[model samples]
Target: MKTLEHIPLNGELPSPKGVALAILELCRKDDATIAEVARIAQTDPALASRLIRQANSAAHGGGRPVASVTEAIMRLGMGTVRNLALGFSLVDQYQNGPCGQFDYQGFWSHSLLMGLAMQKFSNMTGAGASEELFACGLLAQVGRLSLATVYPVEYGRLLDGQDGVARNLVALEQEHLQTDHNELTAALLGEWGIPGALIEPIYHHEEPEHSGFSTGSRPYQLVHLFYLARRVADLGLAGENERNACTAELLLLGGRIGLDAEQLGATVDDLVQQWRTWGELLRVPASALPSFAHMSAAHAMRDEKSDGAAALRVLLVDDDPTTRCMMEGVLSGALGHAVVCANNGREALALAVETQPQIVVTDWMMPGMDGLDLARALRATEWGQTMYLIMLTGHENEDEVSEAFEAGVDDFLVKPVNVRTLRARLRAARHYVQLLEAWERDRAQLKQFAAELAISNRRLAHAAMTDLLTNLPNRRSGMNALAKAWAASSRFEQPLSVMMLDIDHFKRINDSHGHAVGDTVLRDVAQAIQQSARKDDSMCRMGGEEFLVICPNTDLKAAVQAAERLRRMVERLRIQAGETEIQTSVSIGVATREVGMTETDALVNAADRALYRAKQAGRNRSCVVVQGQMRCFP
Candidate 1:
């Protein structure tokens, strides 16, 4: 992919300067009086009116109407006041626009649904970052709106191709604008001086799984909550196909969030109800929303596909004509599929293979090759894979049933099988078959889809963690891989090593040749390092001229050898940039995991110390950290 040029940063939207300043100033002081904050909020008349209206809403349960701003402020606590102020400030900033292709009201309604869902989830999980979640949800798509307002032509072009698009728009934005919504939003929030913790979710909302924020990490979880909430909200706007896609995604993510099928269904029901009420409050028309009735029906249809209470196919084998007829009537007329009968075990085997019956009800004492022999013969063939063999035993000894099991019979039906017992057994067999089929199909499809998604996600993550020009893993991937290797080694009591390398006098190369030539040298050096490392080892470009290698199950001796090899490989590699051949050499530092070294920082620190030693000794060599001391290798 070609690199995208940066968009010029000078554009003005509706500035809520007065409101933003008031909210920021109010939040800044610990000793500031409540009256003083209220006085500041009162300066913005629009904000004050909105606050008064919200205070009287059903959500707040402020039964007695408060006519004055002062009365409202006194009734609501400080935290609520602060939240309201922040909400109003955001509304003032983003509420107005030409929004030619974007539906502002619809966006806000969806955002409101997400906020409600996040609040509910927070309460349920004891996550307790609802206010920040609400704010992030509200502003999650602000980047799109910003682009529409600022870059109208480009936005129009994008909108022209927006019909039934399934790809992530943030990725599209990054492809065209060199910046995604997450990055833009994070930058804007930082510019507005919001806390970094709150800004993180805004920056990493689209790809939460790879955001390096753990579920226990407040910012990461909040973003994940918002992502989930938005999908739930989308249930109100999606078409049938889109809803199915969203539901599948929801179910896939449910296990990660500790929700069972029944619990997830209940949560979806609650979200639907909340979405309806919230839509009404936001003045969004019912026609524009995704209906709860449709979603419920779709969910029901999906469930019916795996209900496992369907009809069963039974194969009845017996010598007596009367007994065979009676069993056929019970299985086919009372149950479902036609029951095929065979007088002997030899005949039954032929029928079993041809009919591929789900369950077999056969007499133990039959004429020629009895039930035990038939079960064993069936088990030896592919027919047994689908059939649930049930032997009819006249003898009730436990040892007899053990012989039946040894012959691959699933269950024993004693002579004169009762109707209720027969029905229950058939049902159980049907359920087992259905579950097996469903699992097989789901596993195959999910594995294929997951493989494709993993590849795409890995590329995106690589892009996020790599230097585009150098084609090497960036600082983030380097650090992350290093940390991961360190943890694995510590946990398993295995050897681990890290190598940090830097190109000697890289700036001189850039100055002597042009930056384009410098880029060629960097790429050549990266290729050399990549070729030097083992397949399992990780090679990363840690900004500018520095690189890092994470080697698992490698001791200090092996690590030094690998680092020296990489150093020599780089020295030998030559880059031709516009007819100028440039040769480069690298200095390397190697550090291995030691006893009592459990943390990543310690390993990195050791490698850094060794790197400094390599620099202090002559350049273009390797140094190792041993027993807290640095030793240089010639």
Candidate 2:
């Protein structure tokens, strides 16, 4: 509800000089290659030592020796190298003095846990971009530290208020500084020129919904991951009451992530152990961490209470005295809820107003106000907004059930309702209510988290198969699709076609416009390619600007037609950047598979040759590779 300008940054927070320097140096064009970056990092002996130690840590499973800096750079790749450089640079930033009430060591340990958890989650879900996510998680709460370091007094005041720290911090930050940590951290990251994807989660971790990132965006998911990590940290730091709250919170998050109870338990255990190990490795004291075992046990006990207690209030309305008594007995004695009984619809309405029960069970053909009439009345009331209404009816017709639902009934209980059926309905209603409550409590946070998580996971999955900047399925996805198509073609004995395409002089485009604009162009081209391909056909972004399209159940002639269509589409793609409208074109390489050959590599290789010929005979054309011969398009 607060504006961005309201939250101000405290001036006293420690300057992130080392972190800033490291980020600046890493972002430079001269430090572009992993080798060059490593050479720069090696200039700092302490950083170099830590990098080597971390590379050989148990986490990386270093059985073979990573003897030199070059080997570490080669083994880990550019992303990891950059992350290590940045991480080690900030390690010493928070190593001294109490920044408000924040225990720096404890905070760092928590950050480490979150980083590991994010990585583990990526691995478990087959999500891509684990390293980027890890970096985001590690720095997710850097804003808080920044605030503490900059404005210790204001932060101390903000923390001093225990009643509503979450709400109060936002208000206080806005009142004094005109910017909160969330925005400040984002600004800092932007200043350092970090990738937009990574910067997104850091800035929007707290208020994910309003961050302008789409739902199912990678940054949103990272936000959720960070929240979960923090919750895990809270569980570690919790007392009995806080532990109970954390348990409930975890259960709610687990449900959102589609983790069943058993899976959730296992994940928590693994995360706790990993946190402990990482804490020791980082020299973070044990006292800083919340007792994992204690929290786990407490959470388990709370979960048992949540499962066993049937505290839901139900209103039972029936004309028959015997039926009313039986329903009351069953709900009260067996199910354990405060069951309120009313003989007819009229009485039920009055009692509903008084009791405000979560579920309503009434016989359809009551005397004064019938079940339908009562349900209608309840639906019109404020109390009825969320209450689950069930009608008891003898009719089993589809129309009857539909009418009941239309009249405001959520479910139907047949006349002579069995105990099992009634119990199941009640259990379902309870679960639904719980979910609704959780949804309301953290709607903004959850929505943002879900979106970011989806995007990141999808991007990672896509990355394995497509190009990063282009947002197309990567070569990996292409290969997988090819294999699937091959299997299907072999099974059905159907024809198949494969096409490979490359943007003409993509490097020139990058050189002409900045790489950022070039990235936008590549993305536009990929979108054009996606649109050109048939819905069933598979399209993948090969490294650089090259792309591959797999057309299942198509002959060479159809493949060529498809290729021409794609070429035209690319030519039509006019990208706009401010006043400039940039035009681009693509060259096509087509190959087809007939009978006997089942391998995908051979088909792909054939397409490559066609693409080569298309490029060789001037740009912006289509060519086919058939029986090992390249034929250029007219």
Candidate 3:
């Protein structure tokens, strides 16, 4: 109910520190280079070794084994390297924290299962990238850790009372902490620079049906994947009864997600195998998981559906015992239906609710409460409205048939019922039932398709606003974010700052070392500048060796100092452009919003002017506009 902002995370939300922090910071830049990431990774031998190992891991087998951090970076890409570093770093940091209520080893073990499940599910469904999914799944429940870290004593009490049956942990958390794990999980992921695409699903994964995400949407599918993964983990870790229930639910959920029983079973097997492998690698305990193929086969034997199916329940009502016995024999033996018999219409009406039959066959002339009266009574209720009704009569009278039709009888059987005709009527009823089921299935598929399409459209739109090279927000996205910040600053009367930066002598580097080397330099420069940025800054690639940083609640002096810091960081970058060691510097211009500044574009233009002054005053310097006057910092 309460927002994550209200919950205090003690400024320590299980984030990757040291080299992992540097790696993540570099990876967030749209123009981050592979060489740059490798360089930073190599700084920490443990992180370097882990990256190489991950690149050569069975899960990422494509080429020859990687022997160096650069090779690993090239093979794994920046995103994968970043996530691995983050995951390994967190494992190193939080192995034994102050959270007494949290099962630290169990947490990692379950997280490993979930992560492996998500990766396998992604590979099978082609839902998203498998590498990122592993991290998403692993950190999906990090909010639980956040709560424990923030409120140890209170959360420990909450965990003590967490029977898992009497009180759901999330509900108990909301009652006491005013926020649940999902909320904190989303917030922490966002803070860690994970994408909104992944964060939103985790946020709503707790109760996805009511999450407002459409049933077939990408986020919706992701939520279901997490849910299925959680269930699979439970099945693996739970006792006999829980495992059986989880297996059934897993199969049903898989079907909804477009996986057949065989595919679903195979996926479960693969997931368990991966879980075992990852458990060993991460040093988490992994128990033997229940085999889906074996469990599913056993369940199939116990709850098999025959050709005629056990779903059909037939009610046979007649005053004559001989007729009732004969009808029951025909329906149960020949039609393969579970038959419930009643002596008269009064008894049939009571049995209808008790047995909830799909078909009802009754004698027209009864001692009390005739077939017509029973049919009318059944039709008046909701459940009986769909039940098929038939009347057995001694003679065929046109007026009687009309009256029976009005009373909701579907067909009439005259005299000694012709077995062939009765079979034909039952086949027709079966066809109708099949059509109803088909309609429902078609409707569900349609909803899923629409949701998928909507999700696809949103992703496409996001791509358009993103820079392909640096993976940072493009100029358009930057402008949009600045506009939003401008509105917020205006409302709250807070200072907003903008810095425009340009890599010095970029054109000369392109001309000297060819465009390919220049491109690498540009990427390295972008990453260096991004790494030096603060948490609240919005960094953007403003076309060709030019970058913009938007800082909210920052003053003129602080903005200048940040710009100067970025210039020095960029100045120190010793990029390897092929065999040549290429050094570069940046000229930065900083501007802050004053009382009269109204438009974001004007603010950006002011920063651009200051940037030009920095360039004019010689490169590798920061210039700030203080009271409409340019002040240069060397």
Candidate 4:
């Protein structure tokens, strides 16, 4: 909400420098292209490398890694590149400012970790651009860095008095520095052309309850996400003794987003590994931390001391006799868990099905079915899906790590593992088991109580059939409607047609603007299609950027005419989102049931194929497949 014009500062604030500044300036032009951003980005080797790395990150880069800066820019988009340049520029300049009390290295480390965490969160929630969210997470605390840089001694003294007490640091900043970090952060983000929607969420993320955002609004979710990212960052950078306290709250936050202990732990562990990689690239110190499961389980252990939590059934699979014996000793002796040992993957699989262990710790590079194969086999079974899996590996490269995890390993340890890290990792496993047990208990109780709630069936059924966002029929509802139309057409010998419509370059709109704007466009387009439909036709939001319109008693020619009219209608839409007005066009594929079509699937499939043709022939028009002939209407 607050911009640079509103915020008052006594000293100069942190800003972009070097090529970052040039890219920022160039991106301000209304006609800026990816080439322009890439050209300027190439002038700075560090920026170029970061761009390439970001473009290829697990969240952003899916198929192939970009080798050129231009491809990287194209993948990340202009908006994301500009924001990243700004954030990275700040990091370069403020790595070690004049502040004495501020942990400059720690600050960057925490910020980088937070950035990675946010990227992972985006992937999980599909909330925003993963790279853009990563940049936001990196600069989420830039205000503190700015304060430390601008008022080194004063800010240093202010931080020095923090005696580990929970207090509103903003109020203290107002008392001492006349401007709090939240206001300055908002102002800086706003000045940098970050959307007001995002700025508001970031500004209120610290106190989201006071944000007054609608319960299910985009801003509400982003603000809470920012908070979760912040907390996870704090936990990563906190001292070993202090991290356990952080895990309890972190778990609660993770639960709100549907992450159970094991899932959350695995997600966090993967992010931390990436944090370490980024730290190396940025030359920031990212400390080695124990697995998230470790800290969570430790806290659970302390809290459940009197609850009589059962010992975990751990199946330790290692080919080495010495290593297996030693691990079994630690599991059964030190950790007080029931341990089972297997000499190889084949033996482990046999033992696993026999014992049905709650946790599986296996080493890679074994005889016959390797650890990965074993994991895949176990996961394929219904029983193994819930089991916690940890793989021990000597290799720690990104490729090897990915391979291990993708093969269904929940977590992994480097060879010749540290006992403490192992203990912590296992604690995470133990916590997951405990959570699962509690969940089963709660589920049973709820099932018993829910047996009498059949009266709500109608309401639940209605919800299941309707699309929540557009109030149009959903994909399933559309299919059912299509089936009925098909049945009537067959019985009455009447024509039935369907059109598959897709919003073209929809991702570009969302990238240039934001999802809030994207949501507006979807709703506007849905209403336009619904209102213009024939009385006998049905419409549905088939999913992102796509819709289906079912036309009963309409012939091929009639369906083509309707598709053209709808295309023109969508082209005329000028959806207003804040100061921006977005106009999008649709590509439609139409199909009419023929005498040879026996099932609705064939008719729908024909329409889908036609839709692909329309997209392939260049969007913003309609295409149809009629009697083995394909035609497009420009």
Indicate which candidate wins on lDDT: 4
Candidate 3 segments whose C-alpha is farther than 4 A from its true place: 1-6, 10-13, 17-50, 57-67, 163-168, 214-221, 300-634
- For candidate 3, which ten residues in a row score worst on lDDT? 301-310
TM-score per model over all chains? 0.55, 0.49, 0.52, 0.50
How well is each residue in 280-396 modelled by candidate 3, as lDDT tens digits? 766778877557888877665555344343466788999999988888888888767788999999999999999888889899999889999999999999988888898999999
Pick by TM-score: which candidate is best? 1
Candidates' C-alpha lDDT: 0.72, 0.74, 0.82, 0.87
Of 2 and 3, the candidate ranking higher by TM-score? 3
Candidate with better TM-score, 1 vs 3? 1
Worst 10 residues of 4 by lDDT: 451-460
lDDT by residue for model 4 over 133-249, one digit each (tens)? 898889888888889888888888888776643245777788898787888888888888877877888888887878877656789899999889988889887887788778998
lDDT of 2 at 149: 79
Residue by residue across 17-55, what tens digits does model 1's lDDT show? 676467666666787676777787788786677556555
* Whole-model lDDT, model 3: 0.82
Tens digits of per-residue lDDT for model 2, 243-351:
7677777877777678876687778777777667656655664334344445557677677476643668899999999888988899899888778899888888888
Q: Give candidates' CA RMSD values in order.
A: 10.3, 13.6, 15.6, 18.5
With a 3 Å backbone cut-off (N, CA, C), the pairs that clash in candidate 3 are 30-470, 30-471, 30-472, 31-470
Global local distance difference test of model 2:
0.74
